[model samples]
Target: MKKVLPFVLLLVAVVLALVFPSVEPVTVADATFDTGDTAWMLVSTALVLLMTPGLAYFYGGMVRKKNVISTMLQSLVCMGLITVLWVIFGFSLAFGEDIGGLIGNPATFFMMKGMLGNQAWPLAPTIPLVLFAMFQLKFAVITPALITGAFAERIRFNSYLIFLCLFMIVIYVPLAHATWHPEGILFQKGVLDFAGGTVVHMSAGWAALASALFLKKRTTPAHTPARVSYVILGTGLLWFGWFGFNAGSAVGAGALAATALATTTTASAAAAMAWIFFDIFRGKKPSAMGACIGAVVGLVAITPAAGFVTVPHSLVIGVVAAVISNLVVLWRTRTNIDDTLDVFPCHGVGGMVGMLLTGVFAHQNVNAGNTTGNGLFYGETKLFLTHLVALVVVSVFAFVGSYILLVITNAISPLRVSAEDEEAGLDLSQHDEEL
Candidate 1:
């Protein structure tokens, strides 16, 4: 019944897709469109999409050789699975007509009904609405992929898929709507998440923590990474693609984008340096993995403040985030919770630091569009306090919601591989293949 039910539902969706083709009247380039902005957005969308494959490599290299293929597939699968869901109604659920200041109406853009025209999202007026939606689709794709790092090596493939879908519906969509939707509760309260410190990183990070807690520890916890070179390559790709993730959030190829790009570069560099140096100071050899992870933490830390803070302040954000996350990683090692790859410490804590620092370093001089008053550094308490409260709320919601979803998924599909399967390795046991 379980296997048949999935096939049946997919058949229904297939029938529906064929029945409802997106044959809306297409409009060629309209006068309202700026070629530069549109061109940049097109490039930006492609760049962000590349990050998922990059993530696959990043996570794949960290697991044992037996689980390498399984781990990589988890990240790659989101590209196929989430994109279909996004095109159907996921976009509307995150960006459609406001629903009581909490969510978007799922039917607002059913099957992208009205997207073929010269329409533009209110926030991104230069590009077609469809372009904006596609850009956001990349973000949606990579988020659940981020959580994969925590539960890597032990999760059932089918159960992971179910949990991924449940996560998007219950966790990612609501947070996206609440933070990015103009009328969203958080947005209205002046939460200035320039990219996705709160939306993408924080949500994925807390969910990773929840998954680590719920899944407990692996049966064979002692293992070494399969390929450090793959991790390095993945980090390079992620760093390159992140230019689009942060700078492209400006939604235009203007000064703001340039500012974001500069800040992203500086923050990441500073973080890499800090991470390796901090390790050396601790009498540990400065390793390539440390450098790559540090760079990513920097990237995560500066995501929310990229467009809103100066380059120097971005350096501060990066260094502070790296040091803090390193400490948390050290602490996690001392505890019983095996967060497989320390997703919570690096992404979760890095995101929290970024969000709070944005409240401290953001200023109108950098981006006059900030109606939210100056940050704490400029003697404003409102912004910082608002972020503090939002941080707690987001933490609780993501952790609790993800834990519940894990329980439900376990009931349906059994979240873990069997003991024999675990011994055989997920690649051979689950996929009938081996690296």
Candidate 2:
């Protein structure tokens, strides 16, 4: 029954495409479209799509040689699985008409209906609705992929697939709706996630922690990273692609995009430097792995504040985030919790730091769209308090919700590998392929 189930689902999807070839037109006049914005978004969408593969390489390099293929495949498979889920109903669940401010109604865009014509998302008025959907799809793709690092080398691939779907439907979609949908609770609460500190980073980070805990320690701890060079290359790709991930939130080719781009660059640079310097201060040699991880941490930290804070303050965010995340990594290594590649420390902690700092440093003067008022540093307390509330709420929700989902997934299909399989390496045990 399980063997035929996937084929049946795909067949049903094919039937839907054949049955409803033409979706109805969306609202918004054709003249409202801006070529420049559309063009930039097209590029942005492509750039964001590149990130998943970069993540594959980034994660692949950090796992043991025996498990490298399995680790990387976990990231790459999301490109396929999440993309299918997104096109069918994942997008709707995230961006469809609000369902009581918590989730989008799946029927609103079921099978991507109502995607034709000149419609624009309410928040992104310049780009076509389809473009906005595609751009957001990239965000959805990379998110669960980020959590893969936490349970690397120990999970069952089939079980992981089930968990991935549940996580997207249960966790990522709700968070995306609550943060990005205009009617979302967080949006209504004045939660200012310029990109996805809350939606992408915080949710994924917390889930990563939950996964690491649920999976427990590997049978035999994985050894040193297979290839540091792949990490460097992946970092470069991620750095390049992040311009779109952050700036494209502007939804148009405008000054805000430029501002986001500048801040993204500066924050990543500052974080890389801070990581190396912090390592040196701790009597550890500065290494490529540290630099790459630091740069990515900076990117994660600055994601929320990219468009809301100035460049100088972005530097502050980077430096602070790098030091904090680095410390968390140190702490995690000493603990029994075996989060491979330190996803919680680097992304979860970095994201939390970014979220809090956004509340602290965001200025109304930088983006007039910020009706939330100035951050705490500028003598306002509302935004920071709101963030604190959101932080606590989201952290608990993601962690607890994910652990439940993990338990459910494990019940359906055992999550852990057999000890024999674990010793043989997941590359052969999981997929029968090797790096």
TM-score of 1: 0.98
- Which residue runs does candidate 2 get wrong by more than 4 Å? 29-31
List the global CA lDDT of all models.
0.92, 0.92
What's the number of clashes in each of the models?
Answer: 0, 0
lDDT of 2 by residue, 1-435 (tens): 655766787788889778866567877664388899999999999999898899999999999898889988888889888988898889999999999999998988788787788888888878788899999999999999999989998998888988989999999999999998999999999999998998898889899999999889987774889999999999999999999999998889999999999999999999999999999999999999999999999999999999999999999999999999999999998999989889999999999999999999999888988989899999999999999999999999999999999999999889999999988999999989977
The residue ranges of model 1 lying beyond 4 angstroms of the native Cα positions read 26-31
Spell out the clash pairs found in candidate 1: none
In candidate 2, which residue pairs clash? none
